[model samples]
Target: ITYRLVKEYNLMINILRAEVVANKAGELIMDIEGSEQDIAEAIDFTAHEGIEFRILKSGITLDEERCVHCGACTSVCPSGALTLRRDDWSLVFAPEKCFACELCVKSCPVRAIVAVMHLNGTVLAG
Candidate 1:
C-alpha cells in the first residue's frame, strides 16, 4: 500500500501508528502529504482498493464551559498539546501539536476534553 502510494501517486506517507496481526486484523494511522490533486487521486485509489480511512480533525476538543483549568491534563500530555499558562495558570490547548493521543481525555477530571473524529466530513462528538 505504501509502495503504491509512493511510486504511483508520488505521495509521501508518514506512518504514525500501526498494528497488524498477519491476516486477522490491522490498524494503521498515518499522515499523507502531497499536492491537492495528488492527494485526491491517492484517496480515490485507496477507496477503489477498499481501504477504509478517515480524515480526522486535528486534535482533542476542550469544552471551555465545563473545564475548570485544573491542569491535570498538563502532566499526561506527551506532545505538550495541553499545558498551563505561566502567567495566569489557565490551561492552554495547542491542537496543532496534538497527535490525537487521547491521554488528556483520560486525565480530565470534568470530562471537558474529548477526542473529536470526523465521519463523512461531519464532526462526531467524541
Candidate 2:
C-alpha cells in the first residue's frame, strides 16, 4: 500500500514504527505527505486495497503533575514528537507528529505518559 502510494501518487512515505506478526497481520505507524489531491487519491487507493486506515485521534497523554522531565521518554521516541528543551530541560510534546508507538509509555519513569487509542469516535484498548 505504501509503495503504491509513493509510486502512483508521488507521495512521501515515512514509516515511524511497525509491527508484523507472521501469517497474522501487521500494523504501521506512518506519515504520508503529498499535495491535497494526491493525498486524497492515495487514501482512496488504500481503502480500495482492503487496508484499514484510520487517522489517529488520541496519542500519548502526558501528565505534567506526575512528569519529572527526566527525558527518559524522549530517548526512546523514534519520531521527534517527544523532545526536551535544552535551556529549561522541560519536556515538549508535538501531538500531531506522534505515531502512538507506545515506546514513551514504557520509558517514562514516573509513568507520566499513557497510551490511548481512539478509532472512529470510539475509544479502543490502550
Candidate 3:
C-alpha cells in the first residue's frame, strides 16, 4: 500500500498490493498499478524469500444471489467470517474478519455485496 510520487513532476507511481514478509514458505501476493516495466523493476529490487508477484487481470469477484446452497465461502474463507448454513437466512458478514481487502466484495458475482461508507451523516458507496 505504498505510493511513490516522482519529484518535480506530476507523475504518481502506485503499487496496488504487495507482500513484504511471511513466516511460512509460500508465494507472496502484491498488487501493482503502474507501468509494467516499473513494476518489474520494483519487484526485482528485492529477492525476498517466498515472495512472488503475479499481475492480476480482473481480480476476484463476489457472487451473491447465484450462491445458493453453496458453502464454498465457509471453506474457502481464511478468516472464518463468511459462513453458510442450510437452515440459515441471510448472509452474515462479519466486519471483524474483513480487512477491507475487498476480496469478498469481488467474490460476489451477483454484485449483492456492497461496501457502504458513512460520512457526515450521509451514506456513501465504497
Worst 10 residues of 2 by lDDT: 50-59
Q: What lDDT does each candidate get?
A: 0.85, 0.85, 0.48
Model 1 clashing residue pairs (backbone): none
Using lDDT as the yardstick, the better of models 1 and 3 is 1
Off by more than 4 A, model 1: 6-38, 47-58
The residue-by-residue lDDT of candidate 3 on 5-114, one tens digit each, is: 23322234444543445665443333334565665565554334233444433322234555553443455556766766457644655656654455566566555555
- lDDT, candidate 1, 2-111, per-residue tens: 89998999888889899989877688877777898988888888899888767755458999999999999999998988889999999989888888879889999999
lDDT of 1 at 3: 90
In the range 40-94, model 2's lDDT, one tens digit per residue, is: 8877887888777876555888899999999999999999999999999999999
RMSD of each: 4.0, 4.8, 14.3
TM-score per candidate = 0.67, 0.59, 0.35
Quick one: how many clashes does candidate 2 have? 0
lDDT of 3 at 103: 56
Worst lDDT run of 10 residues, candidate 3, spans 1-10
For model 2, what is the C-alpha lDDT against the true structure? 0.85
Q: How do the candidates rank by TM-score, highest first? A: 1, 2, 3
Model 3 residue runs over 4 Å out of place are 1-78, 86-91
